[model samples]
Target chain A: MNTNTQTTRLYHTALSPYCRKVRLVLAEKKIEVELVEERYWEGPPDLKRRNPAGKLPVLRFRGNLLAESQAIVEYLDEAVPAPSLMPQQPLERHEVRRLCAWFDDKFQAEVTRPILNERVWKKITRSGYPDSRIVKDGLRAIKEHMDYLAGLLETRRWLAGNTLSLADFTAAAHFSCLDYISDVDWDRSEALRDWYATIKSRPAFRSVLADQVPGIHPAAHYAELDFG
Target chain B: MNTNTQTTRLYHTALSPYCRKVRLVLAEKKIEVELVEERYWEGPPDLKRRNPAGKLPVLRFRGNLLAESQAIVEYLDEAVPAPSLMPQQPLERHEVRRLCAWFDDKFQAEVTRPILNERVWKKITRSGYPDSRIVKDGLRAIKEHMDYLAGLLETRRWLAGNTLSLADFTAAAHFSCLDYISDVDWDRSEALRDWYATIKSRPAFRSVLADQVPGIHPAAHYAELDFG
Candidate 1:
């Protein structure tokens, strides 16, 4: 795709689930965006100026500097109301937020951050080699999480509910990153694999599927339509 | 203050800012809640049963078990719409959510969790004495956060904006917990001090202000409305 400087821009890092979640939302909303990959670990001086928290997925939206992935996604949903990402009822919306937090916070601390820190960031940032123990712990934890998700999928079409919402994007963001490194054991939960496959086939997922980090190669079936 | 047992119930621990944020919002909405202090560290089976994440600030509200403090607060605002905590406009709402995430994720990690774990939780759990290094790090970190917040308070009446939104309550939730242990250096920022005093005087803050952990006594000026 040709770069469009005229559209809104996002300061993002490849494989950062937070950035991917926001990217998925923007794509789903059909908002034209210029993606500027940020080296967040280098701690660019301007990053802190753009976002006091000094985090990635900082969106320059219609001149407003928006930070925070969850906040950004929610804002996108509200501001551009085509294909609403949140449910209409308060309870369903609560479930969506709950699962989003489940991925962004719990699953992140237990699985994504630790695994990525050992496997990916160590390589990209030149920090150190992957700690096998930490990687094992993260891998061990993912099974339970995947099983729990499978249980949820048995009852509902989507992670949050019958309707797809931000929860899917948030969960997909983390899973896609893990999948990029071939970390996720998809066969552990057939339901979860199918759930992910369904989401991965979406048009919004194309940009993510095409992502390539310089050092790390995507898994063999990462972009394949019929991975299973 | 009577335990009605019939009104809505909240499973919470006293110094947790997440729980306090939910409590403050409940009080602000005039919803009476029975606060049940859970020994979450003990890892009760029911805790994980109620909240799959095995975290606190779980609310048994209207026959539904709600977890994730931000999700719960947003749900409350949606369910109980009188004196809405969120602004109508999407941008203002984004600001509120951003600040909430700032306190919950950034501030909690940098300051509240480390300091409280060393100073408060260690004693309550009989783990070990307060680690001065961690406490000092948390204390040192607070100066930057306080200055940033003071800058915001210099112009806006509330942390997020002119309106008293959930952002104020979310911030106050962390501040109040720190203040409970007399850890806050209130003199650092007059604007922040005044802001705290103003929010502290509200009736909604009464329950939290009165909180007393068994081994740890409240600060001399913790509950005083005009201590400054």
Candidate 2:
């Protein structure tokens, strides 16, 4: 670890998959960080100052303000070499990044964001009621995504390859959010269920599992190790 | 370059910034790739086969089917190291990736996609008539983005830093798309305009400059070296 006197802090929202991805990577690398929940929807005045993108999961580390979850995690991996979250080969590294995009770009748009926007964020922000149609669409999309993951898991131990990489944490971060709302169907695929259970049991996952968003209770089995 | 008997090919749409970004990187790296236009919006059957996410800019390189624009470009930079598109330092690299995300995720969502959807895509797909309000909103958004880029250029040589990087290509890709539809107000920022002109004059930009989408015309100054 590149030890700096400045305390590493993460500004994030509890249910955001992007924020959770950074938290998971930070924890997996065993870096101690102080977490500050940012109500980004409320649009804090300093939010844009922290990140020009005006998004959450901004990290204050080593005298640098890092934004964008993927960039931050990749920088973390490069800066902290031990317990590498990336594969050595360029081709293998591409696979890890491809899956990260799958979860962050595609899955987040299709499943996580839509579902959470309706289920969690709407309530937190005191916005309109949950749109059942949007929630249903997101629910429908998850099955196909689950099927795809199950097929990938049939061969590789981890999402990207045999070794657990950033892809696993990225995928798990999104799944954990959905799981928190009891939206995941654990019985969809035994392989995926096992994969989640394995990742969920890791020490790095402890902090995320302990997360509880105010005004919205976590699913009963969200933190259970053997629930599935 | 890792030579393989298999011919390198890129399945892409002409006006897609994501595809253009990959094309720019490929050209910048001096890699020869045969371009094949894929009408992804129509949902070609093999689109999903090439990329599970059903996205454009899938590259067949070194006999591997690669998806995701950022992943493909990063892999290219790593695989073919000469004339590197990435900075050596971790912090510098983070800046590049952060800006790439800014253009791809934020700018695309706020400015490029909406403007193109209303102006170009609707005409190409015959989906609906142009919505002036959406186009107006996108045009308005680009001003703030231009101001931000001009601010960066005031202190830095490139969008990310001193040397040209993937961030420059990514930002250029989006700007070019908007420039195609005459949506960009290059006069708004002198530094930004100079940066674009400098990048536009590169030999690597030739293929992108030559792009012609059916029934849609490029702006009079779009392909010009001294556009501003």
Candidate 3:
């Protein structure tokens, strides 16, 4: 067996919510990870070898290449078991995973992906100029999402429940991305804004907030804890 | 508090892979469910109340409405441990989840959704004629997916490991939908075909196999045990 330890590395893009989610969880668990930024859009040859899906946020941990953000974070929660990001009961856990999916799948397709594609990725990749119409639609969709989240926050301490969980990190990851581009109208919902502010203040969020992508500048309030 | 028992119910569509996944897991756990077919595309007003995301495969279990197919199934696995679909080890469990994401997110986007929308949904909703180019692209994508799955089944007894897992069911769920539409070219991969045959023979697959969407007929070999 190869006894020498390999460093825990993550192949990711800085702006990706999926990568941000994994990065936040890793930092929360206090696991040291070497973040190697991969320009996945260029279709890096080795990415396919590492993950058949050729997706961003592929983690190299404990001599294994782990793909899929939700899977990786859930595994981290299960393996490390410190400051657990998952709830104890099955029902609670279901709530956590449901919200995680809500942000990653639904929220992403509606708000994050479209906005980022038009605002950030297009500029970064030198693909095309930003389309105002697409960005407008994304902005419009986010308000409904904000209202829904505010309703949830009124009843619970965190996105999933009374306890902090992966759902919070997942939501923050998406919001942080949009916030970076100054797309979020924080004034729409106080509860949603407060929830973002609390999660943003965490030590786990430091690396994510510190991110600087060349050619596109983060919004002035993107890294502020009290911005809301 | 009222103590009368409530029936486990699922609001779903007949041809959705997400719904099939939940149905398979429920049946596998021997949990009788009332499958209420929801015409989600028509923008059912109650869908928003059931799930703010307004998606299908919403499960009403234990008096609570549960959404997201993966979350519902994972909760089922945890709540009812008998004949557990998830492995005990954290790494193994991660593998199961990774594959589930692979099928649900990646494969569904590349293969299932595009093909189904073109061939099935367009016809059912009276939206438009089938787009052969899109259908062709989806069919082409499935071959690559089959190759990947065939590679995994080369050594392992199941997709994730040596035992039946949520990964297998998740994959079968997507494949069965494609199979129903006669989109999958099963002869491309022997191992993959054998894997599907074995999983299809399970009692859990009965409900999914019986699914019939009006106006769109299932392929002749869709429900056959010895299809390969």
Candidate 4:
């Protein structure tokens, strides 16, 4: 644990689940990095320069810039090589990566898309009139994802196997943000709910839970929930 | 090289770029596995059971199933640790993962969207008229992506770094599929063109080059090109 490097910097936002996944990875790895909040919606010149795609959670190390949350997390995992998020078995590792991609792709497209577009994106981008159709769809999609997640947790203590990996973090990050707005139906998914409680209670999760987004109030239920 | 136990099987499609990426990884890693061709477009019930999302390139090992090309490729690289696609350094590894995600997300959404939608998706889905606006935007976006890729390759022998990692395979897979339909402008991206030639000529790529979809004819230029 004595190998310390001060040059690691992470460009991220408090609300973005993707950013939070990278943050959780860094914390789990016990890596201290300078966290620079980037306003991706504003598309600032500096942010654009740092990431051509203007995405958040862009990690900079020694003059090299890396974009994409998946990439950043993998880099951190490989760099630290402790408390590994990846499994040792090839098939088990595939399961972890598959779930990670599922959250990034399927969940992002289905659940996060509609809700973020309605509640967060509209407020941030000043885009008027949250599409009711999309909001309805997002809400519906969350139920299906929850059912799928419940099934995964039925056999294992955590998603994508017993040990906590990036998959759990990625899923929790998205659900936590949605839960803040009372968008999550905890009663419908007891196993998944219990699993999240464990993750939310982790030392790495304290900062994320404490984060505040301006002008958007969290649901009352979010505060009362116990991690244990 | 004594650690060899093959419990691997790749679920893929001949024409899909994502499937091709996994195939390239398998070849690079010198891993042998059973290949099962899945028709995702008109998939059987079993395929959907294997992958609920009904996406192609699901890798199975010892009763466990893994979906998503990026995830499948990483699992392969880790499973067979020789001929590594990732760099030994943490920072460099991050660069590779970043580039791979870039192609999978931005490039797929922007460049592959139009061409695939217009040419492949249109024919495959047999849906209504192609959206002109989306197609136009995709064409414009491809130009920008090509330019960005050109700049990245200028400094290194490969996309992520000096070695041919999964990033190069991801890019080539997308470009190769697009090339089948003669969608890419080789003149606008001579550097990428040259790099692609090198990728196309690999022994692993032979299966992809030979792929053909029924009722759809490949462009004349595709057969003539030598990736070597």
A161-210 per-residue lDDT for model 1 (tens digits): 99999999999999999999999999998889999999999999999999
lDDT of 4 by residue, A127-146 (tens): 89788889899999999989
Q: Which of candidates 2 and 3 reaches a greater DockQ?
A: 3
Candidate 1 docking: what grade?
high
Comparing 2 with 4 on lDDT, the higher-scoring candidate is 2
Model 3 residue runs over 4 Å out of place are A1-5, B1-5
- DockQ per candidate: 0.89, 0.89, 0.91, 0.72
Q: How many backbone clashes does candidate 1 have?
A: 0
Model 4, residue A182: C-alpha shift (Å):
1.0
- Say which candidate scores most in DockQ: 3
lDDT of each: 0.94, 0.94, 0.93, 0.81
TM-score of each: 0.97, 0.98, 0.97, 0.92
> Lowest summed-lDDT stretch of 10 residues in model 2 chain A?
A1-10
Report clashes for each candidate as comma-separated counts.
0, 0, 0, 1
Task: Give model 4's docking category.
Answer: medium
- Model 3: colliding residue pairs: none
Model 3 — TM-score against the truth?
0.97
Query: Which segments of model 4 are wrong by more than 4 Å?
Result: A1-8, A61-64, A225-228, B1-9, B29-36
